[model samples]
Target: MADNDNRDHNRRDRDDRRRNADGGRPRSGGSGQRGYGADRGGNERRDWGSKERRGEGGDRRSYGDRDSRGGDRQDRRRDDRRSSGDRDNRRGDSRGDSRDNRGGRRPTGARYGQRGDDFTGGPRSGPVRQGFREERMDRRAAEPDLPEGLDLADLDPLVRQDLRVLSKDNAEAVGKHILMAAELVDDAPELALQHARAAKNRAGRVAVAREVNGITAYRAGEWKEALSELRAARRIGGGPGMLALMADCERGLGRPEKAIELSRSEEVAQLDREAAVEFAIVIAGARHDMGQHESAVLTVERMNPDRKDDSFSGLRLAYAYADALAQAGRTEEARDWFAHVVAKDEDEWTDAAERLEALD
Candidate 1:
């Protein structure tokens, strides 16, 4: 009986030691103190064997709450990573939205003089806007070849003064072209026109450049171009000096009625003596073009063509009068006036000498 009791006590001590080694949990398929089939305060412990079989490790309480604390820390770390990723996604989305709001994509092949946003894809800041303007100005028209050693100082002082609005380099280039146009106007009128066009392209706002271009175009027989340039110059400069040329351009364009209209404008009375004489010549020519021979004759007669004056204007007036009389069928009177014009026209400005020969 004593041996059986000792054996039972030793067996209980072995089971307790095994439970302590297994973290004080009951062994599987055994009933011992605090066994799996036992209840603690009417609540059974969780089945750790089933949990381990299902890959859930074991009860967190069995290992002194290590798994519970570790799981909570890991869960917090995972939540932090998820939140950080969400913030990054939001930032990326906002950047895309900003790009769309700015103006999406830039237009391809946008030309010069177009709006600034067409090329930039958005509203330009100050430096960018100024750069775009410079690019527009740099896209200049075709320019003529400038002669070597040509002096910008040779340009008229008044014209140079007008070019002060331009940059120094641009003014110098424009002045050189204007001087070349003036030099070649009467001799190589077509080449003069190219130079004047170059000057006008560089200094379009300058009235003298437009005026020179108009005169060069007139000499080149580009009547319509001459009319347009003269009109632009008149609008910018506000003067009557080019009124006669404008009237002549009207005549050249087959608008003799328009020429007559220009002759009667208030600007006519403001013309200088030379311009007035030239205006009279153009008006008489307009009358002749309209087949009003007597009216044409009277137009030049009002200018008082005199042999004693002998000036350039006087010579041109007398020649016009003689031609008008010839057109009016007053043969003897025309012959007499033509003879007088030939005597005074030493500069040979008129075809009066030829008219006299034709009459004879």
Candidate 2:
């Protein structure tokens, strides 16, 4: 009986040792002791098995023992890191190879007023620029002398004073050219135009320079140049004085519609008698251009050209009226006007006698 009791005590000691090795808790019916499964302070502690399955508890470094879902999370992190590295490498490549941002290169190709590198035709050096400037100076220095028999005494004092805006030498050059232009305008219109152009190159902003240039251009049959210079003159000196010439230039350009439009400005009403007559003649010409011959005759009739006025403009207006009347098939009235023009045209400036003879 003593040996039996000793054997039973040894068995109990071994059982207690096994329980202490597990968790130092008392054993239940079958399993040893439920670790972290008991309620403590109304909260059940998480089990070690569940934490190990999630790979988040005490065995955090045990990647080999991780479940399939944890393994997928690891793979996703690796892919994200690789993708971010690829994006950084692409940005570095763009910065390295884009020539526009490298080596002090401009992003927008060439700068303003600078020619591009592809042009291979011209010698675009500093010597070329200097040569152009020197050539221009030489041409200006060699401007032609004023013609002989040209009168400067009759030039308007105000017109001479206006030339003073230039340098002393330039003012003298421009003044002589202007005087020559005025003297030669009626006889040598092309030479007058050249002088006017020279004066304009020196003092273009002067109203009288622009006016002389316009008149010379008109007489030389340069309608566009005449209109441009006349417009400049009118802009500087606002008056009805240049409107007739501008309308005439428009007519010369075959823009009779524009001529008629300009002739109807409020300035026309305030023109002096001669200018009004000239403007009326341009309007009549514009009407004639549009195949409105009777309207042309009527336009000149409004001027009331008569024997009382023996002026050159009066004779020109009368001749214009007669020409329009003849164009409109009014023969008798045209014959009477031709006789009137023949009576007043003392210098025989018009061919009215031949026109009347043709009518007879």
Candidate 3:
């Protein structure tokens, strides 16, 4: 019984082992866990290659995926490096190029662009445009150091004409500087003489010096000195007013006969109507001063009645004529002449009020 039992158990165990060997199901504990394709040994011997081949086949797919991934990573890294390096280069270039350009600022218009050497399309005068630009910059930079209220003296005639402001070419500007000097001497006679002397020392034939000296001598009560200057002024070819003034000085020195002689000279007769009128008035004043009242009235009557001049020479004669009439006790006629003086003195005849009051 024991032997039979042993035999049955051994047979049953063998059958169970055979069924397990032919079942075609994977092991439960480690299902499908294989190195590459090693499970199909001889039946698919082409698939069951060496560990190196199997590993290569499996590793080829893994290597292909890894290689593709590695290639993408490498490309990304290259792009990052390229973008970073490019960005850095751009930033450095921007910083480096800013210092060279200043007022004439442009991105591409400087050396090799639109302003290609500044000598391409037209002929470039050497250093002219650049020098002018540099000079303007230098002038603007130096503006604070320039003197106040001082204008740059212009020598350019075309620019001066275009602006039409004040022309330095006319030389009136030179007189403007001395205008105050002339006015300062108007009241101070001694200083005026010194100023005239200094001006004469600078250049001969200075009309300004002659005028100032003559006027100062007249003011200082130097009658003979005044006459000397007046004569000198005439000899030096003074203005027409100076001739009138010379006659006046003669009258002032109590030389009525000499004044009459000078006024009625052949030279005086040859002058224009204006000058003749002035001379006639001077003669009338001198005659009146000499107490020749009738002669003074007749002197004005001898003048042509039509002409006029800015000196109002006729007005002076009219006043003197009224005075002479008053002196002669012709009261009614003197009043009429004084009234006429007031009526006709629209040009502001000197001593108009005094002449009118004499008539009243």
Write down the worst ten-residue block by lDDT for model 3: 61-70
lDDT of 2 by residue, 189-240 (tens): 9888889988887777677788889999999999999999999886655566
Task: Give the clash total for candidate 2.
Answer: 0
Report the C-alpha lDDT of model 3 over 1-360, residue by residue, as the tens digit: 999999999999998786555342333223322222235451211211122331322321211111221123333544665565566665655554433343222234554345433312222224456477776556444322212353324323432222222223322322222232254455765555544444333222333434555766676656666667666644443234355556667877878778877765556645676676667777777887788878877777777443243246666666666666777778887777666666778766556568667456
On the 0 to 100 scale, the lDDT of residue 210 in model 1 is: 88
By TM-score, is 1 or 2 better?
Answer: 1
Best by TM-score: 1
How do these models rank on lDDT, best leading?
1, 2, 3
True lDDT of residue 234, candidate 1: 75
lDDT of 1: 0.74
Which residue pairs of candidate 1 clash?
Answer: none
lDDT of each: 0.74, 0.74, 0.51
Q: How badly does each model clash, as a count of residue pairs?
A: 0, 0, 0
- Estimated TM-score per prediction? 0.62, 0.60, 0.43
Summarize candidate 1's per-residue lDDT along 146-170 as a digit string, tens digits: 8799987777777777777566898
Please list all clashing residue pairs in model 3, or write none if there are none: none
Clashing pairs in 2: none
> The CA-based lDDT of model 3 is what?
0.51
